[model samples]
Target: METAVIKTPIGYAEFKGDEQGLAAVKVLDTATVTVIPTVLQEAANQVLAYFEGSRTTFDLKLNPQGTAFQKKVWQALLKIPYGTTTSYLELSKTLGDVKAIRAVAAANGKNPLWIVVPCHRVIGSNGELTGYAGGLSRKKWLLDHESPVKQGKLF
Candidate 1:
């Protein structure tokens, strides 16, 4: 897989995959990259646009690798609106099994597409921010970035 490590507002993100589509887009503490493969340029631009608040949704071709259940969880996550959040239990129920909360959370945790899949939108049942592989602070940053109200914007 071709790889591109680019710096973002929260941290460095390593984007992986080629023309087949984006396989992964995970944050890293540090990294240096000299080239961004041609296929990933659009993904990179979309990510930057997201941080810039000029884009509310992603439209890239994704190819995240995971088990069937995990893929299902990720797909559900994509349905989460940009400024909205959902609880693990809600996701579990959506999958037709309220008892699958833990399993759903586990699959959510394994989401490989980062912001593209929006795993960060899943919060605790009581509205508290919960598990985020990219770190809670970064999760908070992303949520804040997507917030509807801002100091200057009317909408």
Candidate 2:
């Protein structure tokens, strides 16, 4: 599998995949990877555009490997509109679990597709930001960047 690492405003991201599609996008705060290739140029561009608020959706093909429950959770996460927040309970209910809140949360955390899957949009029941593997501050920045309020203010 080919791999590349790029630095974003929020953090450094490692992109790995092959001819099939993107396999992983691991965020790291430091430079750890040896060689950063230029493969999947479009995907990298799209990621930059997303951070710049110039793109609201992604078009790259992905092949995130996860369990069935994690896949289901990640798929549902993609349906959340940009700039909006949903609770873990809400996600659980949407997935027809309603009682699988913790399980859903765990799956959400395991999502290999970051910003694209939008697990950052899921929050605690009290409307507070919850644990984000990418870091809470970065999560806040992403949410703020995509917020309709911020967009409206820019106009």
Instruction: Give candidate 1 misplaced runs (Cα > 4 Å).
Output: 151-155
- Model 2 lDDT tens row, 31-78: 654464556676778888998779998888888898888889988998
Model 1 lDDT tens row, 34-98? 48879899999899898888999999999999999999999999999999999999999999999
- The candidate that wins on TM-score is 1
Could you say which candidate leads in lDDT?
1
- Residue 92 CA error for candidate 2 (Å)? 0.4
Clashing pairs in 2: none
Model 2 spans with C-alpha error above 4 angstroms: 32-39, 151-155
lDDT of each: 0.92, 0.85
lDDT of 1: 0.92
